[model samples]
Target: MLYKIFAAALAAAFTLLLLPGCKDQAKPSETAEVIYHVCQRSFYDSNGDFNGDLNGLREKLDYLQDLGVTSILLLPLYESVYHHNYFASDFKKIDPEFGTTDDYLALVKDIHSRGMKLYMDMETQYVTQEHIWYKDSYNNPKSKYSNYILYDDSAQTKPSTIVFELNSLKGYDGVEHKITTVNLKNKDVLEYNYELFKYFADPNNDGNFDDGVDGFRLDHAMDTLDLKPRLTGLFKAFWSPLLTRLKQVNPKLNFVAEQADWSSLGIDYLTKANVDRVFNFRLAFAIREFDRDKIMAMADSSFSATPAGKQQVVFIENHDMPRFAQVVKKNAGKEKVGAALNILIGGVPSIYYGQEIGMVNGDKPDNVYGPTDANGIPLREAFEWYSGETGKGMSVWYKDTGPWWTDRNMKPNDGISYEEQKGNKNSLWNFYKTVIALRKNNQAIGLGQYQTLPNSNKQVVSFLRYTHQQAVMVLVNLSATAQKAEVYLSASKVPVNRLGSLMSNKSASAKDRRVTIELPGYGVEVFDVK
Candidate 1:
């Protein structure tokens, strides 16, 4: 009897081990950690092409990694003709000019292996005129997508008078817009868009997109049209559902809207749409203006404005805009301060491809692309990946590279580059690197409570970041003159041993009742206290 009982007990244990209820189950929860942006390919390449590409970018990973970049926010890699790949022809393949599909896959796999994430820029606005869908829709009148092609309804009215000009509102800047606008009310087309998202999001097509890419930077996210209230409704119908599906597959998936203005509208839409983050175009615009204190004030105000859980994706430049140097022209000093602010302040800071090198568009004549506007301002320039003198490391995109959209080549900004900045202990590059390191190393800096330090001078701005055990003071001098400030910490547990200055690795000192510090023109100082 004892032997029989032992046999039954063992069998029962084995049965329970194979049963669904007894299996180890994963707790379902959705939360993603913060990721800083290492924006890739916002420049002209050296391989004789006007647009930047994959191999050129692969060469710069080490430089980016040295900057303590944890993730890469790549501009659209899909095949397109424009300098910015907003019109995607094929989502499954990388542009042959950029590199092969294998190359892109390898890049993503290698990046992931190294514990870094890659976010692809997605342009859902228009597809190439030659895309299969466009070809099919144009050829097959009976097909479901036939109605997707939007045509001027001049023939609809009883009088049939052409009151509204179709020519004026037909295309994207009149540049061969062929992507048919499908009526979102149509269930079949809505299903196709969802399927497209599923296909791209899926690394393996096992009915669901479980192993797809990490995130998406939705291109032209705000320019939805052809219907009332444009994307706010359609996105909620399509993207919101897809986001929920994607989160189930990978909880770390992130969705970032691009160039979306009207924050209130965007916030309200995205809040219900359940997007993870919204790009802060306002912050970028403010940064361009170099309204220093106003930038901080806006930052504080905007953070308060967003939904309680939503975060902002902040950037200086992306592929579409002119380089950041254009934003702070002849004010390299202010540019540094802007960088410091973006790095230290809340939100994910995105560094454009050429911004770190301080590359500005330089003069190039006979260039279809002209650097100077009617007002004599520099346009987006070719990326100066190296010193002007050519060598083996010269980018292949530049060999036949004509002038860029900005009609210029990358010129040195204050003689700064990643190579130079990495070496200099007090360089702006180092300042950014250190601040990123601090933010990553200290939870207080990343998730702590924020309070703006009182500043009497309008040109000087300061803020305090604190958590239970740590506190940091960030001060920026917005003007071209040195400024003195007295800072007081209400908390009695003041930090000692001076956690040190971020810009210069100089020893930091805060004694007695207050701390007095002097800031250089367009300078920034950080005190990381205990």
Candidate 2:
């Protein structure tokens, strides 16, 4: 939660960023969050079927805990023919290949034992042909599920798809998936979604949440059902009521919505829709562009836009879009700079699977029109567990299925695997490990107020994360050249006695409270100030 964001502490500025209903509560040092967004199908395989399973993920809890990841945002695990698992064939059943209900419960229990959260991905806006609702109502208007599934004709034979009435989509696995949109306007469908989500929150009908997920990620969450609304204002009419019922089951269960429009700021989802979080898509794109001015401007606005109790989920890569490593052509320096910002920047941060090890994507798609051009296949490849790219838990489910496998993301002896980088102190994996530790160890970075300090070098992104007692200064050179930056500190707030580098032994010089810092090409450095 982005509980209390303080205003910038510059020489000419001082203000409190208090929002509604937050005047009486006492504020503590805020928590630092490192949310690891993982794709279970590619993470690890325990059953030796070339498909990753719940048992494989459970076995890796130690790895996640050691990296200081406070939460896990898992992609959908429902039994769908598509590899991404978006259009679920069954909402209630865990894919047989993934595991049984017992396996899921055990994983949730283990996550809670380590004080980590597990958020389930729930995309119910559309369903595959095999879903019970679609099966019962596709051609029979008199069926009980008639109002549950959207139809384009009064006959109910023409099932409506989401957005432009698209009845089907070709997935990355080279299959055309016929899908049907849900009639969210129906009272029965609304009740069903709430019940299904609540079941995951407290399975076995027990009040204890140990065997349940901590939250739900609402995929492609919309207010008016793709703007071709049979009912308008679903935020208040549909989503608000649905969420209210779930909160009764678990008041603290977090809800994150993926705004349907990627370009939106998604403030309405927080204020009107009653959700707890929204993806900071604007900032993610700006960071990829890497323009110094754009990053600073967008970062400030995106971090400050949310209301008091809501948070913006900041991230560089997810299951969608190209990986940060692939975007920069595997530049080591740029990779470090991008990874640091993802963790240390304001708001709750998320890292996709294999991102800590700097996983790169495969060849770009030559066409988007056919199953032959399955672009997302490369992005969802197997996790590199060994230097040879072959191991006990290697999940290459699509290895021999397509042409994309010829130039897949992982290569033998590329040094991007966890096996080789686990011991190398300078590797990207350890760099992420060290950065996460730094955030956890310091309250200022995790919970304190944020300020974008002005500096002489335009290429350097300068900022301060400070509490009343201490401050942490972060400097990153966005360009490919080394930069020396000068920033004047505000002397009126607190007396400065010491300034030291947190990531290295390099010294900083100060005179009259002005500081001079040196940053290498695409370098990121943090300093502890007292």
Candidate 3:
């Protein structure tokens, strides 16, 4: 761990106190969780079946626990023809390739036993050709399931396309399958979807969640249904009604909406659609930019925009985006800085698998694989579990099947995998552990409200996460060279005791309660003042 804290006598001089108070205290209902987002298909493999399954994830609970993650945000677990599990063929049925109902229930129980939560991604918007809705009503308006799907054509033969007018996609198996968006406008369709989700949240209706998932990630959530005139204001009609009902069953059930527009803050989904959380995509983009002004502006706006009891899920990468490592060109300092922003911020932190060891996208520099394959195949490659590329529990579902495997990201001796860096204290993996531990152990960071502080340096961004009883100050240097940051403390409720730090050099002088400290390029300094 790169963390060292030396507590000194505060009687001499004050050095760690930071900016003052926020008028509104944070709502602590669903805060303090470090979520580890997993594409299970690319994570652990327990059955030697080449595909990462529910049991495979259950087997790695200890690993995740050791990594300090409190929850697992799994990709869509419903039956989908798409490798990434987006276009589901069946919402009620578990994908046979992943496991069965019993496997899912067992995974849920194991997760609960560890005091951990599992959230499954659900994309009820679209369905593949094999889906019961699509199969039963694709070309028949007279079919009983006809209103279950939306069709653009008057004959009801042509189902509405999703995202870019494309109705077919070549999946991980290199097979093209047709897809269509579901009709949420229909009362029956909405009822069916709600029942499907409720069953997963409480399978037995015994009021026990051990046999069910803790929550659901609404993928590509939209109130307007891709700007369709007929589906406008679905938040009040479709989402709020459904989510309100789900919450009645399990008040602790977490719902996060992946808003269709990544550029927006998804605040509507939080307040209108009634989700507990939404991805802080704008902050994620700003972090990757590595500019102080952009990062500060976006981070401040993101945190401030959310309503009470709602939080932004801060993350650097998801299945749809490029890995942060590649975005930073594999720069170690930049990667560490990104880690700091993602974990130390006020919002609930989320970390993608393999991010701890700095895994980049599959280094495929070709266009042989079509558009669908090119988008996420590189970003969602199998987790490099061993020091070398080949090993047991290494999910090689796409190993010998695609050209993407030929030019892979998993290279022997690259020090990117967990096995390669587990023993090295200075490794990225250890750095992530240190930061995660810092967040988990500190009340100010884990459950505190975000408050921006005034700083003298342009290259450095300063802020505080605080509750009534605790406060933690974070000063980050966003430049490429070491810079001096003179920070000022105001009216906030800061501790009156000695200063302790995660800073490498604890040298600083306080005058007027402003401490000047030198931070290396992309260096982050964290202080627990309360």
Candidate 4:
């Protein structure tokens, strides 16, 4: 009778284990991560504010999450007289137009709560005339505030040396190979810059918010010329000590520089300065040649270009340039082909605002340059922030004031509004979304080592990404004609997963270490190698 009672109890426990509400039997795996880009000012209210507040950004977090984005990079938010917010007027204030300091803090808190990372674009090289340091320096160059500027001669331009006007110095007759200036040995300027650094480093001075930011995107760092390498050295010195202080608060902070060019000097600068990443301009310039083989070769050459792999930021356009749509309108297909190449090439891809919607410049000068309307605005005319009737008053980025680029404007409903393409599954928006999503879903593409396929056809470029556990081969058709791809694997019989193709739904099979597949024009295909 006791044995029968014990068996009954055991059977009851077994039944409970098989119940529908039991624990999940599946496990999670550690894989690669992804990041996305969007300008904060791209979203706004109906008041023609031309500023995007954190409150508005919070509402769109779902949109970003749906797109498989893990992080977002924001432009400068500090107070400024200009629209770009680069010429900081006050580092402490949150540009009244954007919102309040409390709002910014709340935004940061919310971002972390959502399990996303937020990076602030730090542009501290220049300040508006209204800055306290500028005002105080102009009033008394010998005062403590005067330490903010490094003066070369103090003779031609008395109070302080203006960086922009350095071209006007004597012997700089507009044709000399180089110009002379005071060595960055200016103790005054060094102390002042360090003080400015301290603000972001420890805004509250309680040593509580030193690492309040996740990463920094340095602006115009290379453009600053010092006769004695003083400026460069000073910048390098700032990083080690400054980063040390920041890491003390948050160890995951990232440091990046916007040097534009990937030269020996630029790479050396980042390495010596202890920066985590440097903008990859070399790749940007090389991709425009419209040769898939060449483009793939460039990616292979730069595998070890710097210390940062997968961490380097790959960008086609930023706030400083016209949307990539405007750039490759004549060769949109080629650029789109390049876009795929960027994804498979590795590194974190950064898309400028309006890239997916095909936003182009209606204003003259095509690229981002030329004049502006009094307030030093970067854009011209009003932009269609969203699509359909929903986006009617969602943005005031261009309507409130004249564009800094006077004759140019981004017209409303010009075939590139968010509404126009959101429903189209075949749209560029979908393409970008899928590519990013694929990166997230695949381990070989995301974290595996990259290897360029040998004997790449001129019109079709192929490469391989492999890890001990898995391998993926990518082949892209660069032209509009249907091209043939011969995929080879080190081992026998692999599964080929065709991506972004309209021709068919079948994935080709490999036999004898080789698989031949038809590739659609300007599309890519990925194969799973076993």
Candidate 5:
């Protein structure tokens, strides 16, 4: 009788789970405040291994927490043939080099225990030739997995027309350079991907919501999966269904896509592909030029173009781009200026690893097509934890591999490491920590509406962020010449007493609801309205 009762109760629970919107409705943590983007292999190494692993990351949680990061967006962690971890051999298995599955679970648990979020980079569009499905389907027409890949049928040689290219492994010799595109429309492939995504969402299956990852960063999220006319709408057809099913299992799971083109803002992804967030690439490109007008204009357009519930992930640099410090020719002041705009702008701020300490990219070969060539070796160099290149916890994955391995921009004891800048008052690392703390502690700055403030100096980009409870003003001088700007705010909007200065690199005062600030070349000031 008890067995029958248990079975009936199980059936009823399963029925309830199948109902639309019947999943547990827990509010997702606010993800927009700040996210730290980490290249896991270069972040920190544990167990005396040169490769940074899940355990290494877990060990460094205190560092991230102290840095005021609310979430971490990691590069791919799945088993891959390449070093950068994009082309996956298996979606379900954690890379052996990174550690076992248990290590990943422990990291996830630690992140949640500390009230932080974890987001993994996922690329379901392609897989390495070594993947089990690819190996089975590559030359065997009779194999059950044969239809899982896209192939050119017109080839004179059987299956020789398989889509193949070097993905981040081009420059290296003796490495497997072939990768197969997954057939997103295939039913078996879809089921495989659905299960993989579901597993990541709730690994323990206990549904306590404390063990699994919170979300994912969809790499190369394009509507046109293959750029061919026939493949153009596959994303809407494929991704939407997969995402819908994933949401049914875990309603709080979120996804951010790296839209194919940086020049265009991806409003289409929000409406068509059903993604939660897209990177603001146009704004990222504009900020590098240090043009106040262009930056503010792009900022306004991005925020305006976004739908009511959607968000834009804003950053000045990432793994696939040149470092912000290098783009500005290692100008500390201009770097700080860029940092100010990144954190103060009204969107989710993502800080690439080593960006807080002003780490710059090393010299690159001339005319390289991508940021760090096909291998992405230089752009994804080891993180500088200390002034000395050789030290405990240092990730020397690409050390002495080639000229790209040299630390050209950062020198030993140059005041750029955590050891060097942790306590320094005016260090770039401190600046980043303070600004992040300011954004987190102040609701007006992190989760409020943004409006550009009027300023006479075109080089000065001033803006106000406010909510019903509070308001704050941000003024940044994007030029090398010292700038004086009279910032005007409505008395009704920001009362006189509440207009006192909060933080500034330069001196400033407020009177009659107006704040006048004099910024030395590339200076920044942030004011709290009460």
Candidate 6:
């Protein structure tokens, strides 16, 4: 009887081990710690020629790492007719002003050696008149590249029906240029773009991703590709196929789409285009106005819409949008509130350069309109490294004499430079650093599940981030007056010892499974729960 009982106990233990293996597996989570979006030309100047370059960025790796950045998203670097580097004249070469191919390769190697990834921006939807394909195909019916670009036959005979007309480049004047859309259906065009993407994904072709960019940001990504009705569904037909081919060459390659429209938030790109990520513009816009309800609702909606494997790129400001500092009138409290929401929210967080120091765009002329307006120039000013006008890492590329540089934004003793904020504990820059450190150090804030918590105060926004091993509670006061609120976590009881303030502008206390915190106007608090 004893021998039989021993055999039965062993069998039961073996069966229990097998049961765990049979259960359904959880989906894998995305792993992007933090992405810093940089406009290279305006970031830093290594040559002191006033233009920021790849070598300039290469020199700042330590500075970036100190700020808890794990990835760098550079704006377009391809040879382009414009300063923004969007209208590419050659996809294979780096812009001459930026640097040579060797410079870019060295930068990539340096970034990877420090355990960080690089992503380049690419917009292949349109081409300037200076592009080789456009130059070769222009009004030349017999040319091999004639079918590569869309053209109107009536434009050849009737000047009034000309589809090709001169237009001013956005953010600059006295520089009118003609542009045409590429024909995505054309086999040659498709093949050319494919090769361009593959080249950047592995420039050396040695299968070492560190030698080249890890991914590409598909600018102006859309389904139709153009305004014409016939162009609809090109993303499904073109992008999906191109992405598949690129992945086969380098399975680790990733793509983030700049969805054409920001009002609607969905996973259509991930589901239909098979892309990896999309910008959460709705959340970004909501955060700008400090709308607590809208921000919480949008955050929850974005989390639900994105499937388990895909991710959303979250940000409060970028090159195209108004600076967060400018929008909030440079209020310290408001800036801190925005920073908390950006770093603590679910999904990957990307910080626009200069945002950490509370940089604001200079006042603009009143008559300007659209992104092309001259007023947009101040939004892309040089980095203020010192309290003075000129110093190390300062790139006054547009100072004193450019179409967009009528007035300088940085003044002496303004206390908005890195030198000023680096030592000040209460500076906006330090707040960003501290919050980012918390996000990086805590796994729950970066990769765990997100849920909006219930609160009676309209001015307070509370949420929970948790995984099996960790849980975090975040509360924010959106108004400009001191506020008090209680966050009830009845569903998940708080452990006595683990309940404490991680980072906050005010004091907080825990009692009877509830967290009661007092926040000054535009204040924020992050708590670690059991």
Clashing residue pairs in candidate 2 are none
Instruction: Please state every model's RMSD to the true fold in angstroms.
Output: 14.0, 5.9, 7.5, 14.6, 10.3, 11.6
Q: What tens digits encode model 1's per-residue C-alpha lDDT throughout 191-289?
A: 665566665566566644323567887654433342334333656666677668766656667787753443332575457667777877677767677
Candidate 4 structure, TM-score to reference: 0.78
Worst 10 residues of 3 by lDDT: 1-10
- Residue-wise C-alpha lDDT for candidate 2, range 363-460, written one tens digit per residue: 45424324322556666778898999798989898787766777777899998899999999999999999989988898767765556767788888
Give the lDDT of residue 446 in candidate 2: 70
- Write the residue-wise lDDT of candidate 6 on 1-530 in tens digits: 11111121223011224334221112334443789999899888888789999999999888899888999999899887676777677777899889899999999999989889999998887777788877787767677877677766723211111122322244354465556667777878889988899888888788777887888898877787534554678767789999999998888787998887667674888888879888999999899988988999999899777865678888998877768998899888899989999999878889999999988875554224333434445666887788887887688876666545646577778888888999999999998999899887876786666778777688999987765556678888999999988777665422323456787434455677677777778877788774
Candidate 6, position 262, lDDT = 66
C-alpha TM-scores of all predictions: 0.76, 0.92, 0.92, 0.78, 0.88, 0.89
Candidate 6 ranges beyond 4 A from true positions: 1-32, 154-173, 365-375, 490-498, 504-513
Give the least accurate 10-residue stretch of model 5, judged by summed lDDT: 1-10
List, residue by residue over 343-402, the lDDT tens digit for candidate 5: 988778999999998887655542232322333655566778887666888887766565
Superposed Cα deviation of residue 399, candidate 2 (Å): 1.7
Candidate 1 segments whose C-alpha is farther than 4 A from its true place? 1-52, 153-185, 206-211, 223-232, 262-265, 362-382, 393-407, 411-416, 419-422, 488-516
State the lDDT of candidate 4 residue by residue for 1-530, as single tens digits. Answer: 11111121223011223333321111123234455555566654424454566667776677677766777777788886555565566766777777777777777767767777777776555555567765665546475655554444443234333343432212111221111132334555444444655555455667555225566676645433422334565455554555555555555666667763334225654556566666666666556556666666666666545453224566666565545665677355655675676666666666665665566654344223321212123322233555542353465554433344334345445556666667778777677778777777776666655566653257777777654445577778878888887655553122334323222354666565566767777767766654
lDDT of each: 0.55, 0.79, 0.79, 0.55, 0.75, 0.76
Q: How many backbone clashes does candidate 2 have?
A: 0
RMSD of model 1, in Å? 14.0
Model 6 vs. true fold: TM: 0.89
lDDT of 5: 0.75
TM-score of 2: 0.92
Better of 3 and 5 by lDDT: 3
Error of 5 at 352 (Å): 0.3
